[model samples]
Target chain A: MSGAVEIAGVGLHRFGRFDGTSVVDLGLVAVRAALADAGLRRGGFQAAYCGTVYSGVAAGHKVLTALGLTGVPIVNVEAGCASGAAALDLGVGAIRSGRYDCVLVFGMEKMPAGIIRSSFFEPWREEAGLAVTPAYFALRAQRLMRESGVTREMLADVSVKNHRNGVHNPDAMFRKEFSVEQVLSSALVCDPLTLFMMCSPNEGAAAVVLRRGGRGGVEIAASALRSHLPGSVLGEHTPLSGLIDDTAPPPTSLAARAAFEEAGLGPGDLDLCEVQDTDSARELNSYEELGLCGVGEAGPYYAAGHTQMGGALPVNASGGLLSKGEPLGASALGGIVELYRQLRGEAGARQVDGARVGLAHTVGRGANASVVILKR
Target chain B: MSASRPVRDGLFRDCGDGTARLLGARCADCARYHFPRAEVCPYCSCDSCSAADLGPRGRLWLYTAVLRPPPGYRGVVPFGFGVVDLEEGVRIVARLTEGDPARLRSGQPMLLVVEHLHDDDGTRVETYAFAAAEEG
Candidate 1:
């Protein structure tokens, strides 16, 4: 890949709930660490792409200003969980378009309680009470249970497995393990989805420095993003339409195809994968959409441990947002940070030995999706 | 159970004072029109985007009554959430007013009307809302 933009370095601070630190503060720690990892002077970047949702206006500048980096162009991006991926895309676009050789991409967020009010949702909706993330996931879970033989205990198992993986991740916020029964009994957020199955919002920052003309730790094979438009194939808010496919071949399958085509790679080429497992059912949904297994087959595959490390496909080996704890904008890049560690052969316990290629998929509440493919 | 808020009126108070509406934003340039008044324009990204009133006319997309909500939001129990597709082509999600849910369905029509969204006290506080309606 002669023209491929490379990730020179990636950095992340310990993932945890921040009661005193601001979003901008967490961003600085990660950015500084990434800059050091790349062995590149922070002053060498031409532009900055900052992804955040709840940090408020000039959120990027607020973080960059703390770094004393000025006069550089800064663009704030927000696309829910896809924000970091979207921001990284912007940096890559700039480098590939010949606008700049190097760019800084990162996502920082500090989640607030009581529904995590999405900056995109209109206030009228919140007042009216239509924007519940768990309920939305629960709707999908309920439907999936109705169609598939998967039960709540099965969903609890997903959390159990992920929490086990989380124990291997030193920086994860909630590293304590849980049993299936424990997960099943956790507080209920939405019907059919327990507090354990649903990712809890927290604060953190993940940054990946990208360079155009230089060799790097990993190569970004391909990246893709899409939005759900009305009248489009199975728009989420539009009930008149159904998913693009019912039997199999999830909408994410299309995105995966495009990413692989762009990178000249395929699913069989991957060594490990990280999917948007905001809700446990969502992880099962990803299994089908990502072509890891057939539709309605994820429950069994997961139960049989096909997704665990050393399995056919080691998924969320770094303790996915589900296990690592949720950090909104930073979660996707956090997954990237995990894949980076795996590819570099630096992963300690949950490492997929000899892994060469990795993919990270992120989806937002607005029904937005993004896929990023990286290689050693 | 979150804090109880007094009934608010006139479309949107959850965001801020009268400076913002449930849907209203001025185009910084050309000043054509926009709703959920954006920080910039759907046509262009400019800080000049001013507040523009969104005249009524829209329809419902989908809705469901929630027996419970995640912690934080304090409102009446058993409320409904629905999607509204404005005539301008932008679709938004909102709370469905008190109505026969049997009247709700996919692609069911709707229109914009001012009504008391919730009551913090006995006095009704109004907010812009979407009420299901006929196609015409």
Candidate 2:
């Protein structure tokens, strides 16, 4: 492709929870996998961007220190769930600006099991019992269900559809699926959101090495980032990075529009995609924001099963975060790994045949969105 | 009598006009303003920011009800929080004073009422929160 940043290789440690594994171990395995795939050494990278949600600063140093004096600078990036794409964007920007010939981008996370805490909320608000992310999204979902006439079953349908797709994805967290009745009947995390509707957070890591695009190439056309709608930071810790827990047009749409422009293509031209499927409803909303179809058409698209592996632009063939499990930091990068496989026709049983173009979008805390376009 | 956490808690002031407001900041360089008191002059990066009070009343933009308790927030499941776009053009996130998520709606008008958050070490940590503004 013209004016694109080439993806030399992508590596992923198995996308399962690393409850027993350390973050650096996951990093080494994934980095080795990527390095081997790229036909390069760890020394090949001039700079590195490591993204993680739970792991704080010096995380990149913790990982790179194992590789020895590569002399490459490492920066730790944390953008909630969208950490991978955000870090990749920085690395890609560095390469596109001609500052570095090759940059390595990686995301890894070992989230505290059970409920997570993103410290972008005010202490007072938290005391008022307004800190959990699932609660916030659940509120929105409840409202959307009321306003959109979307049913709990419809939401489950989204999960089932993605889980079915994930059955074909070896890297997904949940390999099996349950009937809509089961999804509806499952235990509730919130009133309408059941265990099935909500994707479980896992421990995982993903890596990609990038250089300038060349012949026989699969390159990054663009990765666009948008600031989330503003929120009260008086006591910031709002989960999901800038939505600030309660107020504005999620800045995600801006990223979608910008990604389209930057890639010199529109959503209609897309062949395949992987988006943040943290929940069934969010994925449906994303189908609209990604411009895959019209507004409020996610129910129809999902009901008609248009997003299946062979449908009009296979969406989330990697089982998405729903089936694959939401590892937050590694979640978006996992999307990249899946897209790369699609473009290379190496997806084997799940490959979208002759896939020439694809996009991967990941959203983070406070409404930060990152869109990455790829072409073979 | 009992110790269940209040949905929200904050100091209240009588406006003498029946109006109470959330605190905020106004920028001197660009006339831009923020709620919860803007610190860094997000508009022009100028160091001049002045504190002021903003409407506790505003339109509900979007909201969520987190069913799970986050790490720091200790409360029962299913908490409602939404973006209240204040009349002053600053949007701040606060717990929907209406503990009932079922009653909340998008674009619905709301007024802020300071309330209690939780008790600290058996003592009240009294902090800022909102209640569904009383309709006139």
Candidate number achieving the greatest DockQ relative to the actual structure: 2
List, residue by residue over A185-292, the lDDT tens digit for candidate 2.
897776567878988877888999898777577878879987764443321134311222333445566788888898889987888989877877777777776777
* Alpha-carbon lDDT, every model: 0.71, 0.73
Per-candidate TM-scores read 0.75, 0.84
Kindly list the per-residue Cα lDDT of model 1 for residues A1-376, writing each as its tens digit: 4567988788897778878888888999888888888876456788888888788898888877887886889999988778888898889888888888888888888886445666454554455554465556665675557555678898888778788889989888778789989998887665577878987788899998888844655888898876653233222332212211123233466667678888888778889999888889888877777777776677677777778877878888888887776677788889888888899999998889899999998877556677889897
RMSD of 2: 4.4
Off by over 4 Å in 1: A213-216, A231-251, B1-67, B70-136
Q: Chain A TM-scores, one per candidate?
A: 0.92, 0.92
Best model number under lDDT = 2
Report DockQ per prediction, comma-separated. Answer: 0.11, 0.32
True contacts kept of each: 0.15, 0.37
What TM-score number comes out for model 1? 0.75
